[model samples]
Target chain A: MAQSRNADGNGVPPVGGPGAVSLALTVNDITRTVRAEPRLTLAEALRGPLGLTGTKIACDRGACSACTVWLDGVPVCSCMILAIEVGQRRVTTIEGLAEGERLHPVQAAFVAHDAVQCGFCTPGMVMSCAALLAHTKQPSADAVTAAISGHLCRCGTYPHVIAATVAAGAETKGDGP
Target chain B: MNRFALAHARTIADAAARATTTVADAMTAARSNATRPASLIKAGGIDVLDLMKENLLAPDMLVSLRDVAGLDTITEAPDGGLRIGAMVTLGALAAHDMVRRRYPALAAALAGAASPQIRHVATLGGNLLQRPRCWYFRAAAFHCLRKGGGHCFAISGESQYHAIFDNRPCAIVHPSSAASVLVALDAAIELVDADDTIRRLPLASFFVAPGRDTERENDLRPREILTAILLPPPAAGLCTAYLRQGERSAFDWPLAEVAVALVRNEESLCVHAVIVLGAAAPVPYRAQAAEAALLGRRVDDNAARAAARAAMEGATPLPRNGYKLPLFEALVHRAIMAAVAETL
Candidate 1:
């Protein structure tokens, strides 16, 4: 029930109803405590209170995967999820995809393969690829497309997104896309 | 800023307490700003959140049935039926070995929605409860009959996307892909009332036609939470599949979709058949006339074509959607052929 001083800055009421939800969400093995309205979307909580803007919100609706994040090892649209609902679950955002500023393989491949354009959907594309790689060391070409199809890049980065996902999968096995 | 809220429901009673009022009450409250009434029922935020941002929905409070607990499991009943928790994600159900093998049609429907990300978040309960994807209903410009207006604009307006059957008052097609498939599979809905009382009804009975109530979509009352869906196991020797002919490969509503489940006897003659059409009416249009054609006949090419034609028998087309008749005819043929191929 402790207050966190209106952390999200949106000034919206709590999604959890009148009280600050006290909990810690594990982001990339780092425990960060949050005091937020239960209604706070995971995207807002991560980018606002936590100052991790790597998780972007393209459509705010679940349509675009620009707000993708890893929840309990599964890739999900962060904008559609409530922060309090996450509770003590593990949340790995695009910011958490790397190990100490060393670019995650997905992020690196995104650059090597020119998988990013306008950089709006890059963060989500990276996070989704990371999650796909975690579960699948070497996914088929269709698997890569399905993994990132939910994400939309208005700049027409779909080919690159697909390329990046395939590249990441290949990298997991020390091969090529 | 548009923000989504999640209200936790500790139990069915708690969830009902947090649910929106009657359809009339919800519309009034939503229009009146005192509450904005912008909340959603979160079983799977997959389709719900999309409608919200599209301005098709503006719920003020999201009742999170996720915490209602026990709503995410699939259990086998003594009657050899399957009871699926409302909170169970489509991915879970589609991937469940039993469902994939026993109810391949359901798995195909789930896999057709969006991508793995959506299938992972969309719940069976939410899938069945999703609103129609009619252009007139979703857009803010038109005051259609389904929106409680006097006339159904789709009857004459831009209705290539409207219903092809049950074209009386409203013409918007049923948008729940899973519901159509479930209906063909002969499932039932499990409901929990505001007073915590539970009830069950056949899945086919859950939807109401616009001819019956132009303003409402389903039979759900205010404060009634759809807790789970129970599918009586597929009939013996039954083969099922859902065929959706969409405008695109991803994230688009079906222009015309077909759900077919057939139970063939030892001699390869049909004993039971259920065919439901989506994007063809206000509710899932069960092609009873078409099903009747297959009652005793062997499902050959001629029988499949005749059944397909029978299903489209009473369709009254709008100006733009006249093409749907022939398109649906083709889809129905494909569905029947696929279902028939299973025996081979």
Candidate 2:
């Protein structure tokens, strides 16, 4: 069994003890390194040290998709993942959706379809929809619904969200926007 | 969530070694101290993180198996079966063309699970080993029997979502929808112990009954890692289907779920059948009486109804969950009919 040791080869405290470890991650195409406790979640690390507050934490648990992010091109609940486990994977949050001032197709479509009501679940929904459109250029209504099924919108903006995702999927198949 | 140390295991051996060492150190420390810290293995962290946030589990060390290599591959076995690694995510399993074409029941169960984001992150092994979502057990206020308390609160308290069958001292239903389909498909689990010795356990004997062991829901020992799940080759003329009834259409636990795998003979008579029910018991309940009812019988309304009725022969449901009996019957009947329809 491997024992916990510091960089100088000194015996450190057992795992889960009060000790800070250095974590390096590539978030939104920038390499970032931060020292945090082992218990720090990716969502906490992103919002706290990385200053990427676009990924919101609603339920904190995996039940809600409020803290959704793209890990290695797949959508995952950032709140459920430990910061240390992220390692060298590419992390994409809600703030990374656009290229600059211009909004992503899904983001633009959400605004066009009036899908944002409370604006709490918008980031996670956009991330999920963006990931879906990244893989499927022309997704059906059912596909769009399945992509964001885990998300909870108290304002009941599901119909608009589905319409926005499908429209964005269609837009991706066309010319540059 | 409590403060815990984290250790990333690079290999299966490393993960087992770290878990064993951590558990041993915790035990040694407990001998001299009043508190006994625990160690837990995290694969997907979907369920573990929830339990930790709820204050249900507070481990001293979390052995992360995420960096472990070769534990995420799903390969076809030499005997024409499928060998799925423990770390395979539900989304990948659901989207695999082989799984969709060959084992439609398993595919349906995977697709109908938690949500798209959850399926993308939740691994197959972690999903099977997830703790019960029973409100009494989840809330730290209630010290139920499963938490090593004296009594079970769900027995006399609110049990609308509790188990209706195989619920004795505890009433929490099995939370895994994949378990019922796996049991119907006759899958086996491969476990690697702390000593690095591997053992294969039949899926039927994996989950323990509630009364048999209130402390643990499964037979997996501490520091033992579930490495892979082995599925047998599909039988000829076999057709399978899965059906679940939940309060919401998505992101909700099933109230009653059923999986049926039926093999028909040349004359359209049932040759073999396995009917498994979920959310109705503490463990996945295999309806032996129902399977027997379908033997040598045509896949018609009468046979389906007979099998469905036989499934709940000795079910003793609680006051609130009595509706589950009929729900199980209907689901089982529908699942069997769906499977039969697939053959046609």
Strongest candidate by lDDT = 2
Classified by CAPRI criteria, candidate 2 counts as medium
Residue-by-residue lDDT tens digits, candidate 1, B36-88: 46344566666655655566555656677776679899998778888899888
Which candidate leads in TM-score?
2
Report the C-alpha lDDT of model 1 over A1-177, residue by residue, as the tens digit.
Answer: 223333243323234543556668778778988887665778889998889888898778777888888888788888988777786778888776666878888888889889877999888888777777777777776877778778888899878777777877776784321
Stretches of model 1 off by over 4 angstroms after superposition:
A1-15, A18-23, A174-177, B1-6, B20-25, B28-41, B46-61
Worst window of 10 by summed lDDT in candidate 2 chain A: A7-16
Candidate 1: residue B252 lDDT (0-100): 70
- Candidate 2 lDDT by residue in tens digits, B98-161: 8999999999999999988889889999988888889988898887788767788987888889
Instruction: List clashing residue pairs in candidate 2.
Output: A15-B5, A16-B4, A16-B5
Cα miss at A165, model 1 (Å)?
Answer: 2.8
lDDT against the true structure, each candidate: 0.78, 0.85
Sequence-dependent TM-score of model 2: 0.94
RMSD of each: 4.5, 3.3
